[model samples]
Target: MKNLVFALFLLPTATVGSAGLAFGEDSRQLATLPPPAQEALREEMRDNLVALNEVLSLMVAGKVKEAGEVAEAKLGVSAMGKHRSKPMDARPGPHMPPAMHGIGMDGHKAASEFAAVAKTGDRDKALALLPNLTSACVACHFSYRIR
Candidate 1:
């Protein structure tokens, strides 16, 4: 059952990859945002990757609480508030497709939930939630492209 669940999650990503290869062009839908907004979004995504790395490092170091703090500060719902304060031209949410926006929101929520679990200082508990947090990102990336 676990293998099946993993395979199901990978199926969309695999399909998208193969389709892109077959078409000799990107097959994902374009997520149309202004250049500034695009830059902002890209930067935010980079930060998210850094934050995830930090969380994993902390977890490996037996600092589950610190990992939770990092997750909350960088990827959770609080990060959404920071996003709102971006310069007008850099606000990506209003410009994104509804589906894309929804996926992003879900990812943030998942991050928040993961942070909450991590706060319990149970690394196993937090690890169990990581896939839920990351799947939102996988779903969106396979479904849309910024360019």
Candidate 2:
């Protein structure tokens, strides 16, 4: 199951580039945003990637509670509050298509769920939840892009 989970996580990365090439000229829908919102969204995405790495590293180091803390702080629904201070038009959520926004919300929820489970120090259960946390990212990236 661990191997299966690892493979599932890698599958998207393994296929993304080839899928794009084979399909010709990225067919993903373009999400138009105000320049400020776009920049903010991109920065948030970069931070998310960093957080993802940190969570994985912490998990591997057997610091499950630390990993959970990072997940809640960085990827959970609470992280969404950062955009509240931005102008409505300058917030990514307001600009995103409903489906795209739903995926994004689902990803955050997944992270929150993973964090809760991780805090219990159940390594197997936490590992099982990995795909739920990551598949939303894979789906959203495959389906939409900023332009």
Candidate 3:
């Protein structure tokens, strides 16, 4: 059952790997922000993606707690970005529209949830939550683009 769960998670990530794209975006448009803001957001997201990779690698290696540590520290609410215009939060103060901020916040929430589940060191439970986490990524990408 654990193998089945892990394999199910691996299938889509492997497909994403072979497709040479992140989160299955064949083509996506840039969000119309200033160049600097775009770059800042892009860098932050790139870092987050790298962190996600590390988390997955750790998960595959049976380092579930370590992965959870990384998730809480790097992918949680406060770690998304410290943008100049606005912080990415569920609140209405960010430069991003409420919908965009909501999406970003949801991503953060998913990461936090993953961290919580991973902490238990139950491989099956952690693996089961994998899609919930990745789906947040896919949803964010589809809803907004970085320049």
Candidate 4:
């Protein structure tokens, strides 16, 4: 089951432009924000990537609880235990388009579900959720451009 899930997870890259997936432009133009705001967005995304790495390591080490905790605390859509993306409306200067915000929120929602499933120690279910969570990332990346 794990192998199957893992295989499906890699299917998009192997499928040569799968129609169900979104393909993003190589370069995306973001709104003109002050240097600080740009930095903040970069930092937020960086932290998210870091947390993802941490969770993956923990899960691989048979630390599903820790992985779930990290996901709930750091990866959830509204997670704010530490660095977090500011609300779109609250951000200074121009913000992401509404569609971008929606996709981001969807990613968060997927993360939240993944964390919840992980907490149950149901490896199969947790593994199943992984693809869904990651698909949100793929979809968002396909649909958005950040410059």
Candidate 5:
């Protein structure tokens, strides 16, 4: 199962350019705002990511209901909030750093999807989806400055 999870981590890169944008760009843009605003967004995103990790860990351990609850509490809500924050054209300024949008969405999507799978108690399907979730992490790391 661990090996399966690791393999799932590799899936995003295989499908990278298929998605239009780079990873973390949206969050990176958000990060460039005034420190207070940026920190708020960062804290929110960090919390969501932590929840996602916990949910995934639970899923891997076959703790389906608990994982689903965490996903509902964290990733699902966070993704909806993050996704709602701007119009598509709200690009970063010249002074702003490079960013990766795909990863942020991928992580959110993965958590949501994992939650869905956990609700069904299908560990195999949940494990199968792990790669897509991991892809987001890898894509963001590869494309962003992350300051």
Candidate 6:
């Protein structure tokens, strides 16, 4: 009976741990770039997505300090050069709207928050924060169409 009770108690922790690892895997997969870029801007967007996934996976794995470092590095990479204003001129058409920059920025913010929560070593807090981090992806996708 004691063994059965202990097994039951361990189930939820095991499930949550597995889920966290699964999320990390999924985030890493999302970071991959498509083969061959015809235009510079398209390549930039693909690279940014890859960078975002790197930071997100680190957050899910409870590596906040490393995630922050990755985030800063990604920001620097993404911020390189001026964004072209015209859609036809932009590599990946249609161009992202000026207002939609918030979507990408918000995703980074959510990733940062998730990493901070995970660093506390509280599984409950990390789990609770996970959905917010994912929602940023959905929000960005809704506002920006990727080719």
| Candidate ordering by TM-score (highest first) | 1, 2, 4, 3, 5, 6
TM-score of each: 0.85, 0.84, 0.69, 0.69, 0.55, 0.42
Number of colliding residue pairs in each model:
0, 0, 0, 0, 9, 0
Once fitted onto the true fold, the runs of candidate 3 whose alpha carbons sit more than 4 angstroms away are 1-30, 78-81, 84-93
Error of 3 at 39 (Å): 0.9
lDDT of 2 by residue, 1-147 (tens): 233345456766767657747655767799998999998898999999999999999999999888888998999877877888989877888899998898888788889999999989888888888667677777788678997
List lDDT for all candidates, in order: 0.82, 0.82, 0.69, 0.66, 0.57, 0.52
TM-score of 5: 0.55
Q: Which one wins on TM-score?
A: 1
Cα RMSD to native, each candidate? 3.8, 4.8, 7.6, 6.6, 8.9, 12.9
How far residue 58's Cα lies from its native spot in candidate 1, in Å, is: 0.7
Choose 1 or 2, whichever is better by TM-score.
Answer: 1
Model 5 agreement with the true structure over 1-147: per-residue lDDT tens digits: 233345456657645744565553442223345444445556765775787689778877779778777775677534555424544333222223433443455566666776677678777776776555555555554444425
**Candidate 5 residue runs with Cα over 4 Å from true position:** 1-31, 77-79, 82-99
Q: Identify the candidate with maximal lDDT.
A: 2
Give the per-residue lDDT digits (tens) of candidate 3, residues 95-145: 566666666777787778888999888888888877666665665565466
lDDT of 1 at 90: 89
- lDDT at 44, model 1: 84
Please provide, for model 1 over 62-114, each residue's C-alpha lDDT reduced to its tens digit, 9 standing for 90 to 100: 99989899989898888895657788778989889997788888888888989
Candidate 2 regions exceeding 4 Å error are: 1-23
Q: In candidate 6, residue 85 scores what lDDT?
A: 52
